[model samples]
Target: MSHLVSNAATDKISPTLPLTTDQKRLVDQILAFTTAHVNETGPAVFTVYGDAGTGKSVILAHLFNQLQTASRTRPDSPLAKTTNYFLVNHPEILKVYREIAGKEPHLLKKDFQRPTSLINQLAKGITTADVLVIDEAHLLLSQPDHYNNFYGENQLSSLLAAAKVIILVFDETQVLRMKSFWTEKRLEHLLAHYPHQHVRLTHQFRMQASDELVAWINDFTHSQVRPLPQSVGAQYDLRIFNDAEQMRRAIVTKNNQVGLSRVVSTSGYPSTLDGGKHYITEGHFHLPWDQYNYTSTPWAELPQTIDEVGSIYTCQGFDLNYVGLILGPPLTLSPQNQLEVHLDRYTDVEAFKRRADITDAQELTAIKKQLILNSVNVLMKRGVKGLYIYAHDAHLRQYLGAKAH
Candidate 1:
């Protein structure tokens, strides 16, 4: 496959953050493999597997910059024959990358494309770089391209066919929708055909919370009950609010004092609740979920958006100073004192598009419930400094409050 020269030209070849030691080692290994692939005309696949906040994106960005520089400075080197591009599924993240390009005009030639756009281009015979780096690849469809309306069995197959070097940053637990979800077996099936290397990242860099707090979060979200460490709660600024109104006020105070804090929640209420004006309400607590069309707007960045709220979709790939998460109807505590997920109560219908095909209602319900729990896990871990939560369910709220104290 020839390198997509246009994408390489359009890529903003700069590293935004420094890679940690483990990240640096992975990049070095990838580059070394890519160099060999370029020389021998063979194919290679690389996977960076990690949970949220492992710095996977930072490593990819840094590697892209290094490759771009080598291709320019050493025209006769193996890197010269290879071109690269960055692909993201989220429009908000694409907007952020474009804004970064604006600051560094030289990166304007580097391409940052949405998966659907790139797939369409490829279908039309437009090659997009020999080296394709995909971030948030867990969102890629494992089944046929039904959502994109393309002529392909799946994205992974098409990507392998189009690129000489394919780098996928995947977090299986982050899968938000059923249509695009991939299992480990599916991922392994794809890797079986290519020479591949897998690297797993474990460090948590996004949140400033202690290790014990992080562990508690993981356990709670996974349905593994564990007592919250008193020291951990004291160290981190975690608060459970019975009243969503008070939580909102606290978020505002944090925003005014520190900055980069906002309210986010599960789509338990209708997406167009209150005509999409005031979608969230409970005893004087009124807030709206993120606007559906703000995909192009960096909702989390703009200073004027303090009043606006976001859901898992909008704030998934970004970090924040403080996060006020509304644990709406989708999450609750069962009479047995166990965490329960009410999939039917969740309002994110678009994500549950394949529900009609589920023959086994029990299994389908379990999957839906897990997806909701995964969304909550993602939201809770977004804050770099603190996580403030307001559960709509009284029992769940009380339970969380007890844990916090």
Candidate 2:
């Protein structure tokens, strides 16, 4: 509950303490480049790309620690004084970092802000920090509309203009909205005019599962038609249950046994708590999503949230010991024997809002489907020890059970 007093508080961001080999290599490279950039006034750009559990944030934290140490050793180092870190997406994630840092729970207000906030500051000539380190860069909006978007322009250019040394931690698959469509091609094109380095971190560090299990998870969520490898089946605790109550009970048991276990589901089911309905119900199983005002603690960390479900917005960019995932109404099996997504079933107004005018229904449908699939991918991969699934559609459940088993 203590607040960190300084932005350079590395201890708070040290959750997955030891960096994997891939992460360490990237951090070392960034540290060396940052040192040179500071001494010579050289402009530099670098991107660290990875999937959900690939330690992108971990590498950024390590880089921050290394830079902080260098600044301490060289008291006159400009990089130490000029560098700034920003977590653009997930306030809960910012809280987790603060908790890890163990000091700056209060100072996070200054340390963490949305990408748009940084742009607004730059436009107003608020601060002159040169090095900008961005976590959850995929959430950066290309065309800002709502969410307090003061710049009303592309965030990419605004960020680049704000800092000489640009370090972005990105995961392309986590792009949840249409306005936030930042792609590799666009990234490459932008950096082509500047000196930039692109590096990949592929090591699986968060999920305490094997490489095979990770691959299987990736394939399953993306709707890739691949048989679940027997080795992965044996090593990872993946289960498909037809009954949602059974899955919920198992998840509760898992939480009591090991902690850090919670239930998460798609927003396909409507949240009726505001309408005097305490729980979301289907057949005999029902649970409520975390209260909209549940802001004191991160959803996955709190013991009470185990009774409330989490969605992609609540669980992304964080890891858990176990996850009970419910595949809601949006996802189903088509007559062609393929995975189909129903956009109407999804009730996340912000996610499906037409930020840009698109007249074509087909185009809108395709985009919505991709967003749903991405959400499913994120929710399913939150577990470190195991994943328990309950598919709402009977056919999809049968299909998943057959393939996963």
Candidate 3:
């Protein structure tokens, strides 16, 4: 069941070691640009755009390492004595970054912060940063969110005003919330006015699957349901299972054999913040949704997570050896045989909050559906070696099973 998925921490952000050749080139290019433009009068932005697993964060990690190295130890370097900070919105990913920083010689835990924290500090005149790097910039809030203590009109705009230079990673298809909703067109419009440079990373660096299989995944997430590829996985371990219980057993076996394998699900089952376990049950397969991991280790790295069903929030931007993915109640095969999202059946209410900028009823509904599908994209792309799926809709399962065999 194993493919050529590297066990080395390449896809995962590496603070101490640089990744592949492409990543190294990007790091060098971006660092050179940052060095030359750090003294510019106006804000400058360098954007890295790519789908999940295109080494976006990998290059950023290396870029930050170089920045810190030059600014701290090398007085002759252009970036010397410059203040820089890295920001990420996801708490889980932020935790991983901080953990990695603590182990690296040139980086410190204080160098990383949640986007909100940095913004608040800068606003208070408590901190000044010359260069800022943001991971998951797509998750930056476009509207004021009082709950997270962000009172700014837009996180990205505010950050641009506060810093002299900015570098960010953005994937529009990975946006899963209304508050952080973005499109390539919207992003382009915002950057048109700023001094911005962009590079679109087109190659797949994470999933060991073929280009045909990757295209199929993209089609499915775009609501185009077609027959499963003639080959289920070929070199990869992609497969469709009729029963969730069977898939769970297979994933557990994979985890026991390889490590870093788990069962994850798309929105459908109960999700809450009440400090309790809400189980996702399919036939005889029943497991609690991922609990809040308070420890320093990431959720997928924890030994106990194999017994829990992972959500997008827990699995995004992380690699897995194998993934047993449950396509929950919200996803189904339509009469036209197209993949569809049933918003009414989706259980994640927090992702459906109203956005003031989106007023058209039809437009809002369409955006919400895309957000739901965005979570699916994040979950399916996690497995480095394989992806095992079970659909709740009987017709969808049967349709996929027809081709899986």
Best by lDDT: 3
Structural similarity to truth (TM-score) of each candidate: 0.89, 0.87, 0.95
- Candidate 1 vs candidate 2, TM-score winner: 1
Model 1, residue pairs in steric clash: 4-129, 9-109, 10-109, 10-110, 10-111, 11-109, 11-110, 11-111, 12-107
Candidate 1 has a TM-score of 0.89
What does candidate 3's lDDT look like per residue over 269-300, in tens digits? 99897899999999899999997788877888
Task: Please give the TM-score that candidate 2 achieves against the real structure.
Answer: 0.87
Q: What does the lDDT read for residue 316 in candidate 3?
A: 87
Query: Order of all candidates by TM-score, from best down to worst?
Result: 3, 1, 2
Say which candidate scores most in TM-score: 3
Model 2, span 48-152: residue lDDT tens: 888887777777766765554444455666654554655566667766665554442223336555676667777888865566678888887777666555446
* Ranking according to lDDT, highest score first: 3, 1, 2
Better of 2 and 3 by TM-score: 3
Q: For candidate 2, which ten residues in a row score worst on lDDT?
A: 1-10
